[model samples]
Target: MKVTEKTKISELIKHSPETIEVIASVNSHFNKLRNPILRKLLASRVTLKEAAKIGKCELSVLIEKLKPLGFEFEIDMYEDSSNEKINEVIPNQIFDSLDVRPILNQGQDPFQMIMSKVNILPLGKTLEIISPFQPIPLIRILEQKNHTCICNEKEGIFSLFITKNSNEGLENNVLEKKIINKIDSFDEFQNKISTFEKENKLERLDVRGLEMPLPMVTILEKLEYMPKEFALFVHHFQIPQFLLPELEKRNFFMDYFIVEEKEIHLLIYN
Candidate 1:
């Protein structure tokens, strides 16, 4: 396959697994690709274009690095277009906003916080996000959800304005209903867990002790290769807010119960 700016990293890796190392060699920022779990989570969302921006390197750098691997590239695909401006207008009335710089400073993931606000934001109303740098992954995810984005940067601080499209009411409502049904009560969660366990179709993972993104990464990796008949029971410190949306995107069924401040049980099935 001929590589282009829009080619997804996951697609490249799937085509040639060696592409992971080649791409990661372009910049130190891409070293995370060496982690199998991180690769699975990020590669699917990032394109060669976005990767170049995130890596703070020229697109030609990535293309050249992968050339030795026998991958073909489009002519002049490395030309810089990062200064192209998006013509989206910011809404006058901001419905909700979040500043994730503090969360990042604390070594925490702000994805859950950001998604929570987005889930309730009304159509035509805007949600503003302030951060230290451009959140390319989050922006990509939101754009996929039918939100238009406009980003501005000043003195190193990034302000992102996202507005949900007025035409997405039906689809967003359906997703909201799905979110409600996916959360099970304690009794319901217990019953499903017991049934799966009795049938020996339950897999267990404990992510309570793991760090911020590790827990999310490990869980997704397990789900990626999970058997069709198996359900995964994860022991987590608190509700994995970020994982919920990802699970929904993957068409996975989930049930969870918060046991206490530091104990949460989540059951994921196909």
Candidate 2:
């Protein structure tokens, strides 16, 4: 018989009694009249309180709404909550026993170094140099030597705060601002000239960045071309201990040495 909008469900069942008989037989054994997929779809449509009932008014309203949407469904009214109980219990146990392991020593450490030197070549009143990145530890050392380190990462300019030899300690508090104003802009910093002579040469050279080239090696190399008396080589955790022998073969001079910043232990290079 052709299924139509006007077709009565009871009339169709009467005409095909075997279909009802098969469903009734299955229901007798399983106590489930509707498929699980259809039950879930109905659960989403009907209110929770109405979904729990076999033939609730809200369920009838949902079924009416679903009919036009190509779904002809019925509720499977079973009293068992065993499946939900099992689902809730198993998840916690499964997650608690999960194994997630991490690999060890898979790559070289970026901050690996045996020993390094800070060549604080004085430029009369201030220092001029280029570095791979911000040399914070070296700046601290310069500060200890009564020099203020003003670093501008954006313009790639560094200046040391200095005062007249006699008035050095007196102007310590205003040193940072003094050095900052000197390199206020990239144009000012690039044009400014250093007048530190050999006898009172205060330009510090840190060739450590040259020893261990950073990701910005091209920039460092370009800066190396510019004429500057004393440059600083700020060494960090990048220079490897194993490469120190090969580095020494290249005749690199070392002055002030520190094993690490936190620990003030000086490293003796053979």
Which candidate tops lDDT? 1
Q: What is the Å distance of residue 128 in model 1 from its true position?
A: 3.9
For residues 68-167, could you state the per-residue lDDT of candidate 1 as single tens digits?
A: 8787887465355433432334435578888888886665677766766777787788888998876655676677677887666656677888887844
Relative to the true structure, candidate 1 reaches a TM of 0.70
The lDDT for every candidate, in the order shown, is 0.75, 0.30
- What TM-score, over all chains together, does every model reach? 0.70, 0.18
What residue runs in model 1 are displaced by over 4 Å at the alpha carbon?
35-37, 75-97, 103-126, 131-141, 150-161, 170-191, 198-200
- lDDT at position 106, candidate 2: 21
Stretches of candidate 2 exceeding 4 Å from the true structure: 1-124, 155-270
| TM-score of model 2 (CA atoms) | 0.18
